[model samples]
Target chain A: MPVSIIRPIDIWFAEQIFPHEQRFHAAALRISGSRDEAEELVQEAFARLFELEGWAAIEDPRAYVVRMLRHIAIERLRRRRIVDFRQFADTDHLTLADDAPDQHRIAAGRERLRRASDLIAKLPERCRTVFVRRRIQGESSQEIARDLGISQSTYEKRLARAVELLSRSWQGDEDALPAAAGPANTSRRSGSR
Target chain B: MSIFNEKQRRKRRIAREAATWLARHDSGTIDEERFHAWRGATPEHAIAFARALAVWREAQSKADADTYHLLQSRFTRRRAAAAIGGMGMAGLLTAGAFTSRAYAWDSSHSGVGECKRLILPDGSRAMLNTDSEMQWRFSDDERSLWIVRGEVGLELVRGIPARIHGLDRMASLSHGRFNVRLEGAAMDVTVLSGKASAAPVSAPVVMPGQPALIPIVIASPSEGLLLSAVAPSVRKASPQHLAATIAWQQGEIVFDNEPLQTAVREYNRYLAGKIVIADPDLTGIPVGGRFTSTDPADFLSALELGLGVRATPSNGGYVLTR
Candidate 1:
């Protein structure tokens, strides 16, 4: 059975760091001048943020993230042995002012709730059923498996697929979405044709 | 490039593993020690788990019965279409669906003293302030919204950028939250998050094989643009002003040293019975504070106590005089 021990840092990262992702990406794009580099910069900054001993003490995680992104960008440029002064100069305005956390969270939550159904609607049939039953319907896995006449492992696989697709799409990976299809559909086997 | 691809593949795999663990955990079948070890193995794993958790939480939220039924119908419709395949009936059905959806515009309105929250067809959230009228039309390629009157608070999801129409002015918002209000001959777009560009409605459309040139005024968080066909200007809003601008979302009208007339005008938008300045001399008096938008009793009392302005009962509203 799963032990439900929630970590403080996990909650902090989810609530504080993850919500302001657009700002971080915009900042990274401005500094890096390429989408790939910006992705790397943001990722590296996040990894480094996870490692920070004083992450819990950060008053403004949003601004701290920008600072981390800036530092990562500068470090990469320095290591390259050739820095673009103009690019370096443009990183000055990266630090963002903190908005009221409650307002931000409320707004973000509303957006997520609004989008969740649409995302769920787009899921392939089998996965959608398993996901909706398990998540939205709040049915136990054993109950869902029994009702659907599927094994627990099959239920897990379908749920995982749904989650993976949603995770990618929710994170703004739109252009490269794998064409969704039912498990038994031969068209899906031929790849996104 | 190969290294990047390898890293991307690794990330995807990690995310998949995270999803599996989440599913297992939710099922009450996850092995505690193994799941903990997997999550703590690397920072990436933890981040992936958090990302999945966020989505999981949202999807697992208790939805109204109407929403569940709507989702079920949508799912069934899609499945029916898929099952029909490349038949004449399918073609006709698809065409009928397109015709009905393509030209149909969904509209929402909030009457005086009432605020309404709406979830648009495309999964964007729009909260209409009192006396507001908004209409939206969505398609595969475009998500268009028209703010006919008053104010709207929008939290748009990432997808096709939404084009907001106002009085001879428009703004294209690429997924973000904003408070858009229609004022006299202009639209005030306040960016709470995300990026939006304001331009005139008459801006040239991009034609194939030709370069397009349109002046774009982009607004960021805590920034606003006064979008008018004649002149579009961007301004930064102080935190206090920003707070005041959006306080209407909470059914409160906040005035930060705003002129008495202006404050009354703003408050009148939410009241069935309006507040009027009977004494012209009281128009320019600076007013400050937060008051319930739907009621004017507290506001009137504050004015009487602080500014010594007396409010007398008028026809259906209150008339303030010095």
Candidate 2:
């Protein structure tokens, strides 16, 4: 198809899909955050679907938009994971993947995604709950906290703390809070200054 | 590049490259070879790999936690209700009462469809609704007040509090009261009073033994006979009515057997917007409910049961009618 004739097709698809885009944009922000990155994710997702050469071939356009948007959110989060991984910067290597890392590293290139879930199962009550709600159900912190009878900041702190603990566990460091053999039986919370 | 600057520069270049790639891929373009090449490039490339992986894991966990907790909440509620059965749930008024002495809490007028309150530092209270304004100032010797426009209710705490202690202390006003509707029509006054004086209104200064309605038309400024006649016999509020009046102090608005128009006007006091009754038949129907007043649904529910009116979402708010 010539580029000149194909441009109107973009407009048609955009109009047919505007409501879902708006809803997805709103739902994405509510799930993720009110940051520029989230806005970028929504815009890029819609733009990509609209701009794709195969844009005319979408089956169930709503689901297609959702799938693209969700992928963008997941990928964007992975690229920005550094400062969030601070507390768990030193866990043992051998224990890392075997220690149920799929439950831990959910979706990434080289890390053991297997241990991620197991690591979550080992988290303290608050952090684990916050993690499940935000990442799984795609609920906003406000919604989670409202249901849990707590503040949104408290939920954020829980997630941050949970991430920090997971990083330490993956690196096999022994000081993150653990009830059972935390960090290779290292004294839990002993590193707190 | 030198080893010191070499790794630093490489890391920065790769991070920029990686961020750009992620941004691009987020637009749904899968650049497979370039993404793979970016992953294999350097030790700092490994660092980027680790960072992205960790973030992805945590994001997934948060998603997990949200669902886990929501399911828990849903189950907990269902279980409790199944065990105990549904009853009218009144959240306890556990908040402690405070003698909050603000210099003046938010002095403002009621607009065409607005209602507000004025809080005096000495613990007295006033309600302002529907195109009204009021102001107050406390002095070493007296409590001075002005109702600039609109209607207000004054429940004198000084006298009630003074009587409790039985002290000979006095809270008198230098200038008793200033009745001001001078800019517009005329001033109106009713002394639900300890002692109140009205300006531009008549002489023999009205007292609390009787109700007084005085229209101050001090025409020509010099010839002013404030015609103050007895405001007809009236009975004090029964216990139920007193309870109704004071109910709002506890963040509730109580209306029992009040006409729908009257009830809607009361609900409109604590709410940001108006709840209008368009139908005259609906207005006369009695409404009875104990509502937190901040909730729009409470009003709707009350109207639904008490008056057989339906609430429909209109624009940004609700409209009620039969």
Candidate 3:
């Protein structure tokens, strides 16, 4: 049987780096304009950052990591330019494109986002952790449960509760514009495949 | 409560349902056709789902920005302290050591009857099959890893060369995905994406200054198998076989008219109880299916119905007879 040792670095990464994964992923998605490429870029950035001797010394790890991802994305885009323009054109289908929104829409979206954040912040401690780990960090339920010292079913329940609470908080809002930006539903599925 | 409150509660309930459906869809456990039907069941359901999705996306991006700002502020404070050059550097260095101690060799393993996917520190990925153990070590110059036991499917990042140590062979891969299964003293290396070269662990080290274009041996090495003496073994694997071999990554075992014994052995790797074919003749019977590795009930039922075999619970595991 293999030994199961929980290393301190694992704990540190779980605490510091893992929590910001959603932000890093979002930034990559904005820059790369493809979920697959974004995921890859983020992973690469993490790998590179983890290898750095002074990773813990970095002032803002999330910003540093996101910046590294942006650099990598730019480099990748440059290389792909030489190989094929068609592949670059396909990136326009990204749900989280980096295009500038109208001032009115930006202001409205920011208000909605702030409200959503407030709702998330009001969630029970365990529920909030579960939600952030599962939805934001992109961790598996099993992994989150193992880390939280809970059963997978319990983790799922907490996540469901968190989602329910957030949905309830945003339910009566009149500014929920219909999803008009991109093919949000099918994009993730196709990207994974 | 007021009628307005009641209406708000109803809207919340609908939003909750939509959130649940979205989660189910994302988890890959829901049927797409059924999900589409549910979405189209009523106008309210469709609108609620759209709103839920929008909220989800908005919250995700907002969380990212919030986290970024929070970290930025925290870092600014630390930077101020470091600029003063009083105990900050030492403290940060000590903390860094503690944080990065795990990066030396991130060892991971899959227990018996379990499969696992690992995202390594260096933008590489590894999927371990049942009862597998692997270690990842990345440095400034190179990314190195070793599969100590069982099997692993690896996807290496572009422009980075990796040196992999399997059971009895070492493989040098440059920007590709590959599956390596170690059985006894021999190993099978199948390149799923780019290029890889393998050599016996006992082979003399060949260090050519330039990029070595080795000849890869796809076949498992036998006692008298003559590999090209000078050229290192490198080859592009067939896509079909690569997919079939790596199907375990998706929690499946695909058998293409494989022997009953072989199929049973593969199943046994991912199951608690072994399936023993009592009759030697029955062992050679061909079986084919795409089976979920954890459950053997379907395979057993198919054997009973199609092959007319009887499976009985034995003290050790299960005994199959015809």
Candidate 4:
């Protein structure tokens, strides 16, 4: 519960490293040819970034992440004693990719924000109440718990449930929830009537 | 499968813990040292916490009052089912007074040289270009947008195709991305990835020696349709052309072998201080390059360097001459 003062590293990672996640995942997929391996490669690159001391001095974070992913993939292949040099041959252009936010990326960001709303709506009724009040409406926990005639712990639990489901859903987890909410998984997007 | 399930469970546990920490931080009841220790425990922990923070920050800023009201209105069980049914029945359930009014009709206007992005109630996204005005109305069975002026880029969600009304004509836009501009009674629609069929708002009165208004369907990303009562034409747009069309979204104007007058006029859309060609002869000269839309300094410099032209400050604008 780091309150009041945020770590400088967290800010750098969230701003510089996190925004380019889709690209990193895509690149990792191209190298690994498996979703699970791609996820692991991206996570390992992020972990290495956390341990880096010169992280702040990097001018282009997207390219830095791409290079890191390539290194991590190479390391994994070495450990497994099977390396596909061809897979990594044409990837030099990726490190030189433009870091500017393009029109498609801008649209994707808007879609992400909208998807957040849709995910919140799909939450269970109890969890949705706490989430809408605390997260979206910016109501204090105490105020929401009191207004809803619930105990403080109950409010926290409901909120935590909402957050867990939403986090999984946002990360594209198909089994994030059960049929109690509806189908276990909907498409990437479910239109609101 | 069991191993995968185990991994999933561990991931879920980390996510839940991170969320709890974030909540505690928000409520001002966190132990800072313990929070740092937990985050430093593993790479997955740090990643989980970062994801939670991203969601928290986005909801804190992007989910504005309108979205909040919409969420509250659809808070009930039956209404939630209706929303999921995707049958456009949620609006008919008397969702809420503020909810219906807020979602049924909304309008926004962007100032000159300023662009704005909006998330409509039906989850559709619209970006208003400089000096643009638009309004949206969503009912139980229909979704429509009215571009009163200027340009708008639309990304319609998958459900009901949206009806676009501009000037005296209209277009039916299905799920896709489109750039639509209203220029003096004409609607220019460039479909980036969608389907659009343009027609007049009313039945055309066929008269002697007058061509009847024909409907045009633009189905490919390489097509742009100009919809007007007088003359409606479909033009093939290359990939480069499409990129140039939406370059304004990135605060850029691209000129590919375009006349100097045409480029100047396009750039003028995003500038407060207009650029005037004092020499009429230079107007027809072809110019090609990309320049920032909001500034004319680089553009003028390019003109000066490319051709034997000079710019002089005149009446809060720039006058160019050979």
Model 1 over residues A1-193: C-alpha lDDT tens digits? 1214335455556556765676788889899999888988888888888788887557557888888888989989999977789987888765643333332332344455566777888888899899998777767789989999999899999999888878777655652244455765454444221
Give DockQ per model, in order.
Answer: 0.17, 0.04, 0.08, 0.13
Task: Encode model 4's per-residue lDDT on B62-122: one tens digit a residue.
Answer: 4542453343321122223233344334223322322322354679999889999999888
Clashing pairs counted in every model: 0, 42, 6, 0
lDDT string for model 2 (B194-264, tens) is 33323221223447785445532221111111111222111222223333444443445665445567667
For residue B60, what is the lDDT in candidate 3?
A: 52
Report per-prediction Cα RMSD to one decimal: 26.2, 25.5, 26.5, 23.4
Segments in model 2 whose C-alpha atoms lie over 4 Å from true places: A1-193, B1-132, B149-200, B204-234, B305-307
Off by over 4 Å in 1: A1-5, A96-108, A175-193, B61-322
Worst 10 residues of 4 chain A by lDDT: A98-107
- Roughly what TM-score does model 3 have, to 2 decimal places? 0.40
Please write out the lDDT profile of model 3 over residues B1-322, one tens digit for every residue.
3755675566667777776765554444456677678766765566455444544544555544445333232122223323443433333332332233345677999987798888877777888999999987887786878778888888878756787765334567777667777653434566545666565434445677745344344332110111121223333222123335766877767654456887888889887778888999998665555556787776777677667888898875789998
Provide the TM-score of the second chain in candidate 1: 0.67
When summed lDDT is taken over every stretch of 10 residues in candidate 1 chain B, the lowest stretch is B72-81
DockQ of 1: 0.17
Query: How far out, in Å, is residue A76 in model 2?
Result: 60
Number of the predicted model whose TM-score against the real structure is largest: 4
Docking quality of model 3: it rates as incorrect
Over all chains combined, what TM-score does candidate 1 have?
0.46
lDDT tens readout by residue for model 3, A1-193 = 0001212233334334544455566777777666656756866775665457775345445556656776776578786636455544544433234322222222333454566666677677888898787666657777888988997556656776666666544432322222223666444333112
Q: All candidates' lDDT scores?
A: 0.73, 0.44, 0.58, 0.70
